[model samples]
Target chain A: MSMLLLVRKETVSTRYKVVVCRDLGPDVMPLLRGKPELELVVWPEDRACDRRWLLENIHGAAGVIVMLTDKVSGSSLQVVSTMSVGYEHVDVNAVAKRGLKLGYTPDVLTDAVADLSVMLALMAGRNGGIGISVVQKGQWTEYPWAPFGFCGPQLSTTAASPTRKIGFIGFGRIAQATLARLVPFGITHCLYSSNPSSAPSSERDAQLAQKYNLQSVKRVDIDEVARESDVLFILAPGGSGTYHVVNETLLRKMKPTSILVNASRGTLVDSDALAKALREGWIWGAGIDVVEGEPQVSVDHPLVKEPKCVIVPHIASATLETRRDMATRAAQNLIAAILGGQMPAQVDLRGFA
Target chain B: MSMLLLVRKETVSTRYKVVVCRDLGPDVMPLLRGKPELELVVWPEDRACDRRWLLENIHGAAGVIVMLTDKVSGSSLQVVSTMSVGYEHVDVNAVAKRGLKLGYTPDVLTDAVADLSVMLALMAGRNGGIGISVVQKGQWTEYPWAPFGFCGPQLSTTAASPTRKIGFIGFGRIAQATLARLVPFGITHCLYSSNPSSAPSSERDAQLAQKYNLQSVKRVDIDEVARESDVLFILAPGGSGTYHVVNETLLRKMKPTSILVNASRGTLVDSDALAKALREGWIWGAGIDVVEGEPQVSVDHPLVKEPKCVIVPHIASATLETRRDMATRAAQNLIAAILGGQMPAQVDLRGFA
Candidate 1:
């Protein structure tokens, strides 16, 4: 049916134009192409959509689909879709005030991000960065065995560490999924600090604790989250409110044996402070996917050079499965909003404005 | 009580000495020191015990505690405790014929090895080696974001991939623990190939499936396991019988998108074959904590040079908690065997000889 309805350009081009900032790819492009009722203007590129071209072409379009950190200005858009879970929600409020409906690919990337989160935790906890460098530099041959060499704090529970406490700076879906992955590791207690605007959810916390058979899953203040957690995960959103939430003050309060992982936006953590923390042994180690001002991250970047910090390019949701799902979801979101139906993943911006 | 005992000299030194190949660290040395009844001669160096010194001092020892791959030739020992779970059990059989009581730290290192196994599966599946090198080499700056530049197979199950089939070469304690850890990743099916000498127990397999709520956990041939698994774990014992279990024929049968991880003995896997498979894209990637010849591994090693291979020095059980427990267990095992009573972790090598 989609093939038969392909590219039948109609009066909708004159009515409601949809400008896609980047080509969502063959699998998703087909979906966009099948929409005969809508005129599509998609940027044909292998890289990110060219900002100037996107902004110019998006003018007078009824809808637009773009990547993270992109904002639609000249477009008289009814809907905006981003292929990311995180965004500057300050722009969200501004968009909401303008009555522009937003669509985000959220639950799709949760598992991928959560999977990477646990990977980083294990890598950082086991001194993967340092160990890999030693092997790569051919130094493993010279310096090998010692009574306590290459030892780091074990992430899993053991006889020596029967009770495990895990904390999350932001207890969101991704954080919960990561917690689920660590269940068999025998983590006992969980404490988290969520957005201050959200109420402390005792009922939900109890449910979470019961779900994973944890000793306690409590919503505590940020200080308690820092002071007590054996493994702390930063899975919060990025914006002005959460900017540098894990600063030196919070990091200094953390257990020296603990590991800190930031799988969220880089702005949520202070890279210099985290580097300092790892250097000073305030925390055992850290694994971060997104560093503050990444892609621009050089070999000399403080976090990159830190032996205890396992820094990866912003590739948490870079799995082929997640990226494909994201593209399809973004296309579906745009198509749904254009044809006037219930969008699959429309963000609720009721309180934002 | 131990402090009061101190280091009282005993005439037992003339009758039966206790030779320790390596100083098992401060947390554990006290156990041996307090037992003044046993005259202890320990290797004072920080590295692995000097083989010559160990061999010379081990004569007529009542007990001996050593590391993996170490064997005593001229020692009259009642107990041989190794602070490792894996060994060349071929020697084990020869030692058993001499009625040598072998005690190894087993269950203590299972969780740590399992944790590293999962970490490897995640790392290899997500192209961690290539991604990390790119970042470390500063290539990440020039080549930032694309639609799917660094995309690899996602390890965790997703809506698009609701069914996951994980395979194991050897279904042992570490394999079971690794499976338990992967439960939350939505792996629906599991397949494994155990030792041909051991009978496949359907009852145990059924119990495991029921325990993890997996769709099925069945015992299959190595070829079938290789062909079907999305992620394959190598956790079998390393010895002559299991040497090169994952040869070219077995690897060629694996799925193109499959991931292979070796957290067990390196001898079980054919490194040259795996390097070929990865280079030719027979398998997506590999994560190996051990190699065929390690500690002597150079940057020129075929597996090490493979872009898709994530290699770490055999440090799967190299966590502080696990090491501490291993040391304590080794000390306890030696003490128990010498003093006469139940040994904590004596290996039952009845049929090996």
Candidate 2:
């Protein structure tokens, strides 16, 4: 039943020992089991890989398989294969400085993340949570359906408004993929912002605009992206330079008819500012998949309590197919790194250093 | 602020009386007010049109602007204009037998409904409500993010699985619109059922297949739709012939990974059968906007009680822009039918007879 690549022949006499932060599941674990050229040490629990166990096993290893939760550090570590798109949870500079090859699942999860981004935009535009609550909370019978009672801003273009604009904080693979999905919805214009450290892409922008038959797909300043967009997606990565990019000033510029979706990182957005924006109707609504202090959010959390805020736990990339692909890719990365001196998806670490 | 059509100029000796079920808000009411050619008698209550008030005011009316709930059956009524796409609540046969023109709003709400359909599919596929519960209930803290914590089915395809199949119960305008939206999601195959009363379109199917570069877009039967679709959308009309089309037998034939989304009428699906299927994992999940007896749903409702069921009160067409457009269309229909002798988008009721 394994679709995994067959283990290579002509192995070296000595088997290389590798530590896996957690079990890669039945679908992928068989790739490491009984391999003549590899020794696998996987965490034996159903939860996150314990830090102590990782620390103990990371030494004297040729390679390691990890999730975003597992930190990697060892003098003997040759490779660190993480099954997540973002490496913000891991110290990328340190990994590179230690001369370890880093393999991550990026492109494999892009479709899943982009799907969630579009879904979030639609949900937020409709004030979707309120409609869900009316049925879930047994208020449906208490109150009757009225004309224009639950109406929120429409996401699609109608005859009255034939052109719709969408913006992105980061114009990367996921953002472009999300834009591609919005084309059939009759999106006419696009605005996006890239990190100031990165160069502009007018040529690529022209190509994308022409491809989608959009009015314009321009690289603009963050202020313009915030102000002009009817729906804004924050797909930027997290770090100090981009931290709290969607703060008070940025929130103020967003239209009251617009929707905000954060499918990328938590720290890139300011929670309090967004909460205030929603409270004051600065924006129509927000669909948040990641919170600033996520996995620690409370029922009383400001964003959680906002009726218009449709918050999902950090599950943007959590799909059975995507997770399986990620795990399989991670396993393959580990196998390739240890046995063949190469990784299928080796993350370029030179830039981080 | 008025996009309402201008009143016609004709110096008539007498004005025709028209009764409106609900007050069309500021943007629309001006068109009806101060009209020398018409007298308006509207229900003053903010609730569903009071039946007694409507009946009392319906006598001798030239035309009536009614909501879906306000049924019309008056001897002197010449025209009935309802601001809803579905006229199932109104007796079309009776209206046609009485020789009254029926004007209803359609086409304008197509994009809004299609947008909701896609949203529901994504929500259902991701088990979207559970993720919301995890965050909204503050269980996020207790249950830390796991490798597969909230994993459900992925709506999009990846390299490993390039082709995805989508099914629709009805292949009408909204269904085609919904399919157009799914094109970018990498949906490779489409299966739909037009009413058996309608003719098959092999030519249209070929054209659609060529346009979308799909594997196949075939018109199939209900059994095939149930068995083959990874995500099945119920967008059919409501009537006895199609009632409970997705009953126990149809549900039992569906894939365990499939999602059922009902953005159309609820009666088309059997709630008990669907709940049972979900309970036994015969189908993955369901996203329902309309219930058999909606606006009467409670927490105790079988479908609502299902953990995988993402229910929204019947709001598939609820969008601020769409609602306004419908109201304006309805007003235009009433004005044209009474003053200018032509409704903008009149529904032909001859077929009902």
Candidate 3:
């Protein structure tokens, strides 16, 4: 038995190499460091991982943990773990072609993202961005507090009002979670547009409606979504297929009182068109979490300059608990893949293949 | 009979006088103007109603509709209708002593205020205010996006974590509505401190726990609220009894990770104490809708200068639908009082008396 164990130990890789693109905080870094069997190679800086450093270090890595900023395309990696729900930066096809497993943090961030989505919807509808700006700019004192001075559209429905229609660009986990939150606000109708390939399920829609006490929950086309939504959320996956899906045409169809929220990806919206729409009163206002060129968004950015647009940096999943959970998951994924165990959240890359 | 009818017609006032502090809005002005029996007397300016103008115009008015700025103390006014839920600015004793009906817009603004409360909570928890400020200040181009740079506390709970405890200073309609919105975020425990004179109902607590699928819902002392709360909301009515209730002592007792939200009157919290607490990291952060002497909150205000404090002018009920509803209710209240009918939302001042 001693000889057999010795032979097995010799057969297994003595020092498994794992590359971490960014420094996940104390709560998660210790998990990777405590492992004696793994040899860790980290980016060392507090900023985004340098592309050159990643490319150089990832050559012989068995596993790699990356953030949205890192592009993972090397074939040597056996597993690619991303610390976010969206994996648009990574080349899934290249990783999958090499039979590499992809791990991502998804369910852990659903609550955080969903909370912000609802918040953005409320802020946009109520002109909260401008309200805060006015106070911070020292104009609140001079501004007259009239009965209807700062009024914007409401997000909730009341007994005196008709049923409010809420629409979603993508009907996925985050959108569903947001809908669940809106139920208490007397939201009764829900409409969503998803990939046409996804078979429409009326039974599921009915179940959701009954569960949430909503009047109707239907899968609709993009035009119907724009036309009916009092507050529309763009929760679609970011990619070329969804790029500029909500442009001039869709913005024109929306009600003047409607509020548009982009919590998913900025690429799904046209910044120039949205600015034009807001300027021309095509829509009441907008609240955006991500922009097409974020971190690069300056004062000159059209969306940033739009008074009616409430643009926040990409901090939708910036809650401490959620980020810690994401880091923990990413570390665990790397550890599991190195030890020949099933990962907690492995992305199915068969579709990409 | 003809002589008697003519005598009655001559004795009864032909036109009922209503003094409006400000032009309510297009949606609401029509309701008052369309009435044939009521003669409207409105403040001529597009700003806050002038005290002198209000006093002069309200001398012999049968009803007066007011905003928070207007003082409704004249004896000749039979009804004082305010376009807000809070009546702290009004002299309730004087109105009640004169056998006057005090009408307020309550339920109409509940959803709007509740929505803003939740938005503030999320914004505070996620560092949304600072996040936006960073981008707006042109610091985003230079600031590196780290894995955990902009992270703050999470407002939700998950299976992997312990249940989030939500505490309310005053658990009234707005607080309850805010709680209803948080149910889906996996909140399993609730604590609240209301007026000590109010009887605690164990049965109601149990029912609320069961209805929301919460582990427990209990009324506790302020000390317990400070100690156990993960996210504490100041939703109590502002007055002498509640003023500075959450002072330095209470704030010191709160957990460093706890988030404080004040959507109620600013007097309920000691702004100086809260600023110190936030600066010293006694609590995670705070989100305040109403501040002490608001509209007067200057750029150098302590709370405004605190990086962790997310301050917004008192726009909690600034939604167009809510304002319209409030205007409609205020107009209706005046019309009802003048026509010798019960007001839709008349304040019962017996407790105060």
Candidate 4:
């Protein structure tokens, strides 16, 4: 009877299956493999996992790991883990309703995203794209460096102008991290707008200001953020509520010399309006990582065609180290959930559940 | 007799002829124009003043303000000022022998250059050039986001791996400014190589390390710098001693994951050797602002053709504020020297004089 019980336990443990949407690379694959009891059904491809393949393979899976391209539906899975910070593609409501735990990699990408945001701002402010194009297009020798040649607004402050104000649409982790980076650039003031329901924290603002040696950090209305910012960063969460938040009205209100940087959701910004702003000189320039309808953006995209706009296709967190960490975390979450252990970074779906 | 003395005073004041190589823009033109007594001779065209034109126009000038494109020969001028930090194009020996004051705009551009240095580092580490090229080539939509797609090394550190070593070829004002920017990225250690004749600054290094919350900030040999650095910056002056300082030997010594950035002088790094390093994966990538024989870089240039290299025409100080300040300071130096007053930023040429 005891021997039969051991056999039964082995059968139960070996029956557990987990599905991985795509290859998580060598660095992260070992975690899933280490769990001998949990079988990993990985999509063997260099590209994003096929939707048909994912749906077919994920049928009896106890836990599944996904990327932005993979869609999750209401299933009998115990857990779902995504290898990205943003889970807009994932159906969180479906996962919650089915009593499935959700995991995501967030903090690992904060620094990488923050670094890229500052890079974009500096690139826009210094006209880096246009300057580089001149060299690439073999026009450098012909166009002599004039006093104002390729010159845009400065990112840092000078002794002559000691004050620089920075603004943010959403003062979240990424925004705060970006603010920290800009502090050395001699940014004197900061203005941010959070959800209207959120309470204002003057003490926290004062502490942040003092820590960064800034003049002030205040929470303001969206209009004030648009008007006062020398460099405005759009870092709000993406959804219907934030759609077109920075439309024509807000773009028109911004200082003509101020720079606009959107490292957040694309839907938050009206790309047509921004392109028009660049064309009409309503604003100095813009740097966008994500567009309204991205991955679908073509060469003829209005923002891409704008001479003053610098656009990169949604690569704010495309750093090897961060991606590796995120992949590892996602794998760990899957492995832990299947083994009935606590997941490393499970998203709290308590509200939906 | 009183009227004759008044006419003589007017003639003496108006006799001060100043030659400007190009338009100094509104910010600085007004400064020179404010002194109505100084007669201004500016090159009419927007391009770099022709060699013959500058020579002819500078003949009787009491002072001359030049750009990097303008060559200043020894003349019977009171002062020679360059609107750039580097005055290599100007013949200092000739200026000194003629007992003329030399002035340049330096400190004003420190912040701009430093900001660009960080931007270049991030760009190189993140494969910014290749990523943008992919989008511009209309391959972005076709290529779905993979788990490890377009991923490059991270510039910032994580708690799990908290140490990041930064190396500098020359630890000067700009290097220090760059170091300040990297502190928030959690740089643990720094290595630098300086002139062998200079004394070691252990005390100063200790203070800097402590202030920046670093483990160590020590001067080391070039080989050690290559071996120890995760990100190495070439910030030394460009000349014979530093030419090809980071050549094949040094390139081979660098870690395969390391990144090299040259924002100083192009001559300091060997382009062919760097291209080979990147091609062979000896080093991760390179971000170069200035290239050898710049303003002449073609599409066929080895470094330009390198897939991992990010090259920009030398525009490190090409920000509106910095350029404006530089032009103003250059003008001020010329105006002061011509009027026999103390120039604000005169280069001490007393030794040569």
List per-prediction Cα lDDT, in the order shown. 0.87, 0.88, 0.87, 0.85
Better of 2 and 4 by lDDT: 2
**True-vs-predicted CA distance for residue B280, candidate 2, Å:** 1.0
Across A1-353, the per-residue lDDT of candidate 4 in tens digits comes to 35544444344436667888888888888878876787888889788788888888888888889987788663558888998887777777777778888889888889988988998898888787787677666777876667888788888898887889999999989999999988888899999999898888999999998899888999999999999999999988887779899999999999988999998889999889999999998889988888877788888988888878877777888887888888989988877887778888888888774
Interface DockQ of each model:
0.69, 0.71, 0.66, 0.67
Off by over 4 Å in 4: A1-14, B1-14
Please list the residue runs of candidate 1 whose C-alpha ends up more than 4 Å from where it truly belongs after superposition: A1-15, B1-15
Number of the top candidate by DockQ? 2
Predicted structure 4: clash tally: 1
**Candidate 4 collision pairs:** A320-B152
Candidate 3 local distance difference test against the native: 0.87
**Candidate 4 residue lDDT tens string, B1-353:** 35544444344435688899989887779898878678899999888889898888888788899988788663568889989877667777778888888899888999989999998898888887777677666667876777777778788898667779999999988999999988888789999999787789989999999998899999999999999999999988786768899999999999998999999988899889999999999999998888888778888888878879887778888888888889989998998887768788988887764
Candidate 4 versus truth, CA RMSD in Å, comes to 4.3
Model 1 chain A: ten consecutive residues of lowest lDDT: A6-15
Q: List the residue pairs that clash in candidate 3.
A: A152-B320
User: Per-residue alpha-carbon lDDT of model 3 for A244-291, expressed as tens digits?
Assistant: 999999999999999999998879999999999999999999989888
Candidate 2: TM-score of chain A is: 0.93
TM-score of 3: 0.94
**lDDT order of candidates, best first?**
2, 3, 1, 4
How do the residues B221-307 of candidate 2 rate in per-residue lDDT, one tens digit apiece? 889999999999999878676789889999999999999999988889899999999999999999988889877787888998898
- lDDT tens digits, residues B150-205, model 3? 78878878666767999999998999998998898888899999999988878988
Q: Is candidate 1 or candidate 3 better by TM-score?
A: 1
